[model samples]
Target: MPFRRRQLLALGALGAFAMQAQAAEPAAFPSKPVTFVVQQSPGSTGDLVARALGDALSRRWGVGVVVENKPGANGMLATSQVARAKPDGYTLLVSGSTPLAFNPHLYPNVPYDLRKDFSYIAPIQDAPFVLLASPRSKLTSYGQFVAAAQARPGELTYGSGGVGNSTHLVMEMVVEASKTTLRHIPFNGVGPAMLSTMTGDTDLMVSVLPSALGQIAGGKVVALAVSGKARVAQLPNVPSFEELGIQGPPTPGSLVLIGPARMPQPLVERINADVRVVQQEEALQAKFREFQTQIFSGPPSAGAGRFLREYEEWGAFIKARGIQAN
Candidate 1:
């Protein structure tokens, strides 16, 4: 053979050897600690779920899992941070429906686009909101609440976690459906909003089942109706908005896991599978029930589709009612 031909043959052999060597290397998906960024305060529902999941995942992967709380801007702060993080599957986000579904329609300029900036990992859980009235108020049932609102338009005050949040939007739906006007008082978080209602600062407020569970049990607030398709087991006596002939979104909020966009397909599948496995455990399911949330196990695409539907549905509602964040 000619000198150049021999040189080419030798290079081809070396290339084959390199490829074989690379193929022989072991797979190392999670060789380091993983971080889960939660979009709520330490004691919030989102934080609790994230910590539980992190604990389970850490045990499964035999690595440390850290949960970081970045609570502000209606969850925009934590969402933006995760959206911009490296898509190596190390950084993830555990958040509720506000940032993913409602924020885009509520704000003029959101920091990140849900479809473009993040990958939907899997849905964790979903829960309904209960319309609670101050015990001091005479609004014991849904009918009385509406009648009072209609009788005194803009006189009844309702508090929410914040402007453009699930608490705010769900109450807006109730007000529109009943054709009554109520003053809105947006608080910093659900805890404060629940407190305001219990203290009679606000006449009524819509709160997540878990957040309001204790208050309802303690008789601090009276649950007039729930914003769900059917009555929640925790509040069996409380009627649902649907039963009261109120048409609106099915649930008040949903929680989902997400990661930065452009994650490797293998990594996405692995994480999604692991999440499903984690949610299937009996212990975790019972824990989720304690939070008044149902465990969600579905294809990764389900989360994305739900987000899109909610965005459009809420956008139409907000536009029709001219609801703006305060």
Candidate 2:
């Protein structure tokens, strides 16, 4: 062959090799260990879910899936770390709606933008919140709670995990929907906030059902109303906010799986499909019920859209209510 002919054949061979490599990428994903950067500390709900997911994925892929707990800064630290990671599916983030949906609007200087910095892979679990009242407050029903709040206006106080927490914002939604005024008392954590409600330091408070189930079972606080559209089995007598004629925020307690932005579409689909399989397992289903959470199903883009919708919904509520993080 002549010099030009040889050169053309070499280029064509190289191009074909490159295309083969590109095509094999998704199938060859997790040739090594994968990491899940959990936004909450060990033993936290987020951490627990991440570990369970990691285990399931490890079993499915025949490769180790590691869970790294980077708890602090209201999930910003872990989230930002994942955001800066390479877009390969190896490094991922496990977090709740508070970080992806509520944090950017609450904190003025959030380092990462949900829309720009992450590829939403899937939602793992949905944990709904419950609105509880102290016995001293003499509130037993959602209707009475709303009536009392309206009657007392800003005098009735509600406690939350912190200023910009989902617990806080859910109450703000309740306030806005019921057209009532209630003072907010922010605490360092949900434990303290729930304790305050039990002690009558605050007349009412919001808690995720898993954390609140023990207290509700013990009758430490009155379960007035729950979040989500339907009543939960644990609190059978309590009505959901929807049943009480008020709409709560959408998917407020969903635990989501996400990766760095610009990940290849095939890899994302692979992860999403694997997650759907893992979530349907009987063992995982038992764990979900134990945690008082349910599966949130959808494609990868579903989580992305949910974050945007929630950000807009709670952004307005936070600004109007003058809520700020501590």
Best by TM-score: 1
lDDT score, candidate 2, position 199: 91
**Please, what are the lDDT tens digits per residue for candidate 2 over residues 241-319?**
8888776457488778899989988889989999999888988888877777777878987777777888888777777
Reference-based lDDT, residue 140, model 1: 91
Off by over 4 Å in 2: 2-15, 18-20
TM-score (all chains, Cα) for each model: 0.92, 0.90
lDDT of each: 0.85, 0.84
Q: Residue 230 error for model 1, in Å?
A: 1.4
Q: Which residue pairs of candidate 2 clash?
A: none
Q: Write the per-residue lDDT of candidate 1 for residues 129-210, one digit (tens) a residue.
A: 8889999887899999888999989999999989988888898888888999999999998889999999998999998888
